[model samples]
Target: MLETILKSAFEWRNQLGLLNESEALRIFYGPGESNHPELQHLSADLYKDHLWLTAWKKISSKVLDEACEIMTRILPFKIEAIVLMDRSVVASEAEVVTLRGTSRSGRFAVKEFGVKYLVQMEKTKHPGLFLDHSPLRFWLQQTQKNKTVLNLFSYTGSLSVAAAHGGARKVTTLDLSKHTIEWAKENWANSGFSPEAGDFIYGDTFEWLPKFKKRGEQFDTILCDPPSFSRSKNGVF
Candidate 1:
C-alpha cells in the first residue's frame, strides 16, 4: 500500500509541476525492468536502492521549502492580528527586523538596494515581517513625509513605524484589543522612536473609523488592513 501510494504521489507530483523538470520515468524506471517499489517487493532491489531513496528525500525537502517560500512571498497578510503562536517580532528599524520564534529570534537588516527582503516565519499566521505589502509601504514613505498617518486595524503597526521612520508628521493607531495596540506601540519604541509620534486608540474600528471621518477630521495618509470578514451591531463591513 505504501509503495503504491508513493508511486501515485510521484505521478501526481509530476502533473503538478513538482517533478516536471526532470524525466523521472526515464531516470527512475528505465526499460530494463520495473523500478517502482509497488511493482516489486518490500525487500526487492528497488526498495534497497539507498542512493535513490536518499536522493528522493533530499529533493522532496528542497522542493517543499521552495514552494513554501514562493507562496509566502505572494500571500497577503491576514487582516486578523494575533499573537505569534510561539514566537514574536521586534522591528529594530525601518530596515532591520528581529524575529524570535519558539526557539530563537535574531535580527537582520534589509535594504532594497540589491538584496531581497529577509522573511522570518513566526508563530503568527503572518510571518515576522510582511513582504507582500512592500509596494504599499514604499509609497507611504514617499508620500507621507510630513503628513499625519492613521493605521486602523493595525496589529503591529509595522506600517506606523515605517511611516514614522520615513518622517511622517504623526501616526495614530486604533484597535479594539489593548494587547495588540501595546505591541504595536512597543515595536514603534523599539526602533528608538518617540512615543509621542503615535497615539494608540483602543476601541472598535467600525465605530472609530466613521467617527473620525465625521469629525471633519482626516489624515493625510491612512493605512487600513481590515479583516477579510468582520461583524458589528451596525452591520458587516
Candidate 2:
C-alpha cells in the first residue's frame, strides 16, 4: 500500500511544474472520491521541503513506518519534516502530530501562481493558505483590474493578494483573528506588496457587513468564503 503511494507521489512531482516552479503541491489526496480506495482517508501536501499529512482516522505505527521509508526512498531532496493531523480532532482544535524531522517554528513561504504566502505551521490549524482555492486565486489574478475587492472571512488574505496582483485598485480583507491578519500582511509584503496596499479588518463579518451597508461602502468584487460554522460574541455564523 505504501509503495503505491510512493509511486503516485513520484508521478505527480512533475505536475507541480505545470503550476509553478517553486510552489506547494498536493502529492496525494485520497480522501472522499479518490480512486485509491485503500488510501481514501489519507491526503498529503508538500510545501518546499516539508510534508503535511492528514487522515480522517488515526493511522497505525506500521503504516507510519512504511510511509517514512517509502518517502525517504522516492524523494530526491532531503525531507525536512512531516506534520500529521487527524481531521476529526483538528476540525475543532489546531493540534497536530509531528511525525518525523524537525518542526518549523518560524515563518515559511509557499508559492502559488508566483505569489508567496508566509505560513506558520505550529500557529494554526491551516498551513496559512488553502490549496483547494488555488484555481480561484489564479482566476482573480487574471481578471481583477482597476477593481475594488472585498474578501470576507479572509484567512491570511491569499485571495486578496491575488486580486491585488491582478491590478485591483484597492483590496480589503476582513477576519476575526488578529494573528492571521498579521500573517496575511506578511504574505502581502513577501509578494512585494505593502501593508498599505490593502485594508485589513479584524472584526466579525456579521458585525461588519451591516456597517458596510449602512456606510454605503460597496466593492466591485466581493469574495465570501466563510467556514461552515463559526462563533462570535454577538452571534454565530
Candidate 3:
C-alpha cells in the first residue's frame, strides 16, 4: 500500500508539473530518521502546512479538516470550502433534512458557512468537492441576479445555494436520489434561502430535461455535473 501511495504521488507530481519534486517525494515517504540533510529541508511541518490529502477517504474528519485548511492556504481561490459526505450523511452535527428517496438507498449532506472552504474524502474515490468550479461560483455571485438557475445532478445543491446568495430569482434542482434532494433542501434552508426559491425534482434528469425544453422553458443559467456514466429511467441520455 505504501509503495502504491508513493507511486501515485510520483504520478501526481508528474501530472501537476510541480516544481519541487524532492519536497513532494519527502511527503510521500513521510519523515524518517535516516533522511539526508537536503531532504531534511522537507519537514513534516512544511508539508503539513501546505499539502492537502484531497484523496484520502479513510482519514478522520479532524485530519481532513486540517488538510482542507492547508489546501486553502495552497489554493484559496480554487476552493470556497471542503466537506466529507459519505453514505452516513450525518456528520459534524450539521442539521440534516430528508428530501426524497429511491428504492435502493443513498443520501446527501449540507453544512452552513461552518469553517473550512474545502473538503476531502474518498467515498467513491472522488472527494466531495468541486474546486475546479469555484471560479464559476464566484461568477454567479457577481452576475446572477433575479435569474433562475437550474442545477442538474445537484449533488447537495451547493450551486443553488450560491445562486440564492447572489440574488437568483429562483433555482430548481434535479437529482435521482431522494436523500440527496432532501439534503439539498436542507442546505438551501441553512443558507437562509427559502425552500420555495428552488424547486426540487426527484427522478431521472433525462425525463425532466426534455420536458422543460418542450415547455418552451429556459433557465437563465444551467449547471451540469453528470457522473462519468449513468443510466436513467428513460434511456442513456
Candidate 4:
C-alpha cells in the first residue's frame, strides 16, 4: 500500500512540477472523486515547512513509516514537521497525529499567488487558509477594484485579503471567532494591506446580516461560505 502511495506521489510530483518550488501545495489528494481506487482513503498537503497527511480511515504504523521515508526521498527541502490529520466528514474536530518532526508554536505564513496568509497548523480544522479556493482568490484579485466587498463566515479572511489586494474600496470580514478575526488581521498586514483598509467584525453571521441590511449597508460583492452546521448564542446555522 505504501509503495503504491509513494509511486503515485512521485508521479504527481513530476506531473505537477512540485519539486521545482518550495511553496504550499497539495502533493496528493484522496477520499474523494480525485482518489485512486486503491488509495481512496489518503490525502496530503504541503504547508510551507510542514507536510500534512490526512486519512479517511485508520492508517497503520507501517504506512506511516513508508510515507515518511518517501517524503524524505522526494522533497527537495527539509520539512519542519509531518503531521497527520483525520478528515472524515462526520468528524467534529481535526485530530492531529504527529508522524514525524515537530511544529513551532503560534502562527506561520504560507504563500500562494504571491499573497501571504497566517496559518496555525495545530489550532483549527482548516489551519487558516483553504487551498482549494485559490481560483476564487485569483478572480477576486483580478476583478475587485473599487468594489465594496463583504465576506461572511470569513474563517481567517483569506477572501477578504484577496479583495483588498485587488484594490477594493472597502472590504468587510465577519466571523464568529475573535481569535480568527485577529488572525485575519495578521494576514491582511502580511499581505501589505493597511489594517484600516478592512473592517473586521466578530459576530454571528445570522445576527449580523440583518443588522447590516437594516443599516442600509450594501456591498458590490458578497461572499457567503457558511459551515455545514454551526451553533451560536442566537441560534444554529
Model 1, stretches more than 4 Å misplaced?
Answer: 1-102, 105-123, 230-237
Candidate 4 positional error at 48, Å: 1.0
Candidate 4 matches the true fold with a TM-score of 0.87
Q: Worst ten-residue run, lDDT, model 1?
A: 42-51
lDDT of 1 at 169: 83
Task: Looking at model 3, report the run of 10 residues with the lowest lDDT sum.
Answer: 96-105
| RMSD after CA superposition, every candidate | 15.6, 2.3, 12.5, 2.6
Count of backbone clashes, every candidate in sequence: 3, 0, 10, 0
Candidate 2 lDDT over 96-147, as tens digits, reads 7788888799888877777787766665576877878888999999999999
Q: Global CA lDDT of candidate 4, please?
A: 0.79
Predicted structure with the largest TM-score when compared to the true one: 2
Tens-digit lDDT track for model 4 on 97-139? 6778887667888777777777776755666677778779878
lDDT of 3 by residue, 35-114 (tens): 33222222221121223222212334454344334434443133322333232333343322211111111222322222
Q: Return the candidate ranking by TM-score, descending.
A: 2, 4, 3, 1
List runs of model 2 lying over 4 Å from the truth.
Answer: 9-16, 19-22, 32-38, 90-94
lDDT for model 3, please: 0.51
- Pick by lDDT: which candidate is best? 2
lDDT of each: 0.47, 0.79, 0.51, 0.79
Question: What TM-score should be assigned to candidate 1?
Answer: 0.50
lDDT winner, 3 or 4: 4
Error of 3 at 48 (Å): 14
